[model samples]
Target: MFSELQTEIEARYDIHFDDLSLLEEALTQANYINEHPNYHGRDYQRLEFLGDAIMQQSSAVYLFKRYPDWDEGRLTELRILMVQTRSFAALSRELHLDHYVQLGHGEEISGARNRDSLLEDLWEAFIGALYLDQGQDAVMNLLEQVFFSKIDTGFYDRFVDYKSKLQELLQKNGTVDINYQKISEEQIENNEQIFTVAVQLNGKQLAVGEGKSTKDAEKVAARRAYKDLTMDK
Candidate 1:
């Protein structure tokens, strides 16, 4: 029944699921099951939960083994960069896993497939399903091939902690109030909203930026604020 999907997955990731239903479960959103009353399969939520823990464990192990010279604080930050929403979403996009996600008609029409949060969840769910169908070694091998390989090639450089950098810079000259304010939100196609956020220092706006979510917009604003403040010095 899932011959095509199985073929594509194996071709892309060099891995295969003995039980294709597990793959379907990973791709199935809650709304999809809600819309299909006769559907006996489960949604991705539980798998996502399990996958999240697996991802964290894999990241911690990788960091510990690879960066033996680094301390706990530095390793923790690097692991955060590895498993964050944006990173997972980006990885899902790179693998074209978003294309396989099964959504309800409403969610499909609403552009949930393109949402970063959904993509992140889908990635985790897929990982969870894979672990169940395969094993821990298979999960580790897949991550090494698809995810950690990218890290080795500097994929993580894009996830710089601009927010923390900006805060540290602003606090260098004694403590000052730092805030991120939403200036506006505009609805785009498919009901997706774009948020505009401004980074403020001492109640004064430093820079303004925009993104698909508030957190992303704040990151952009912080990056801009950091750059602007540093460029003057």
Candidate 2:
């Protein structure tokens, strides 16, 4: 199973793993260790931690060079958005990294293999493995290949802080007392939670949004409020 994946990664990413074991460790979730008593101590948690830092640094450098005009605050915000959990999870899905993850029998049966948090950690673990196998250059190359095309001037321009924008619009129109309330939450199928948020401006409900999380739902609600407030005039 891993042999074909190894070959595919090598061919596509131009990375040759010096130690296949490292790659194996990257794909092994903690749940896998619980299933095999002999492998109880083996887990990818540490690798995920190291990979997370490596990815953050690599993305910061990439953004620095790509957007020289951006100040530290702007760059930091962009970096945060780029390396966010949602972004990493999305990237994992694009690379089909979930297919290569190793899960325990119970986790596999429970479909934990496809969980976003697992996929995000797997992506970081793979980064750590690449860093150890080939060094920073190889890892940088892989990141560039996967993320460079997605970076553009528009990414900077369109990366507005919806919350800030909503607050600004509300304040300018004498509605500075806007509040975001979590109306409800539901665990949908596939272990995902759906949250609904209501955006209230000056004690009046402006808009509502539903999303996979309360934060996402609030952001969407803010976006809707922003649009409505801007257009109301």
Candidate 3:
């Protein structure tokens, strides 16, 4: 299972794990320990937390240097999109990282090994393991090859929250009232939640959007609001 991933990483990212044990530990899911009493209890959760921060900081630094002309708000929006779970899941898929994940009998039978959230967490754990075993430079190189290399200026621009841009536009135009309200929320399949958000301006509904989270839905609604407002003007 891990051999395929090793080959994939070597061919695609040009990085090889020197210590196979580290790689194995990195890919070990929490469920893997539940089934085996002899396994002596080591999981990737701690590493995932550490990697999450590392990934955020690394992406922040990269974006800060790459988009010097972007304002703070725009940069923040871009960074949020970049570090989102969906983005990490996409990266995991691109690298076939799920193949290397180790799950116990129950999780494996339940297909949790291939879950986007689990895969994304494992990917972050893998990054944390790389940082510990090799160093920041090695992890950075791997990130550049596997993820950052594909990010273009246009991609960042597209991912930015248009609602923020609209806010600036509205402020410039002497209008300051903007708000978002959550209309509904539901738990969908695969442990995901859906939220509907209404965008309002001056106490009137502008537009609405449904997304995986209230914040995401509101952002989408804000984008639509921005479009509607701009077109009206």
Candidate 4:
């Protein structure tokens, strides 16, 4: 039934599915199921949940090993950015996966197929299908093409949270309690509040950063500290 999509997907990813139903479920949206009523076709929500976890694990392991110097917080943030709804949607669009989504009449009228949330779910569900039909390695193969390859080529480097990067650097050998203390918050000429925060390592102030909020300030401080550490290395 999904022969055309299967052929296209196989040609694109260089892998054939043992069970075409996996691909079918991945493409079938909930609305489509509602429209079918008595039809036994499964929706993608359950698959999406599973896919979410799989992607998280794959990216976590990849980031952990690839960026040996990055800290937990930084890795968390980077993974967040990578797995964000829009990110998944963009990846789906790039694969032309959106074209294969099975939507209900109302959904097609409402244009749900092109939406970020729906596309994101479809993408995750597709990953879930790949994992179920093959295994983690198969899903990882797809990730390498979309996610890891982008990282290697410096596509996502700009989004790195430097503060987390610094924290990760400090804890490379063992546990380290890092502190970000708020120094001051004052109104500037435009009446906008600005904050200064100091990042301390082992009771010693390593660097300070200024921003519009404590979180931003801490991130700035961490970026500075990371810069210093890398320069010294």
| Candidate models: Cα lDDT each | 0.88, 0.81, 0.79, 0.85
Q: Order the candidates by lDDT, highest first — what do you get?
A: 1, 4, 2, 3
How many backbone overlaps does candidate 2 show? 0
The TM-score of candidate 2 is: 0.69
Q: Estimate candidate 2's alpha-carbon lDDT, on a 0 to 1 scale.
A: 0.81
Residue lDDT tens for model 3, 1-233: 66677787888777787776777777887677877777864688888988899999998998899989887886786688778776787777777777777788888899886687887798788888788878889888987876677676334434566778767876896867888889999988898899999977788888998889888898788777786776534
User: Which candidate has the highest TM-score of all?
Assistant: 1
Q: Output candidate 1 Cα RMSD.
A: 7.7
RMSD of each: 7.7, 7.7, 8.2, 8.2
Error of 1 at 126 (Å): 0.6
Which pairs clash in the backbone of model 2?
A: none
Cα lDDT tens digits, model 4, 1-233, are 47787787689887678999988999898888888879797988999999999988898999999889988887897788787787888888987779988899999999897899999998899899989999988888878887778865645544567877887899999998899999999998978999999999988999999988898888778877887887644
User: What are the TM-scores, per candidate, against the unseen true structure?
Assistant: 0.71, 0.69, 0.66, 0.67
Better of 2 and 4 by lDDT: 4
Off by over 4 Å in 4: 157-233
**Residue 136, model 2: Cα distance from true site in angstroms:** 0.4
Sequence-dependent TM-score of model 3: 0.66
Question: What's the C-alpha lDDT at position 170 in model 3?
Answer: 68
Residue 54, model 1: Cα distance from true site in angstroms: 0.3
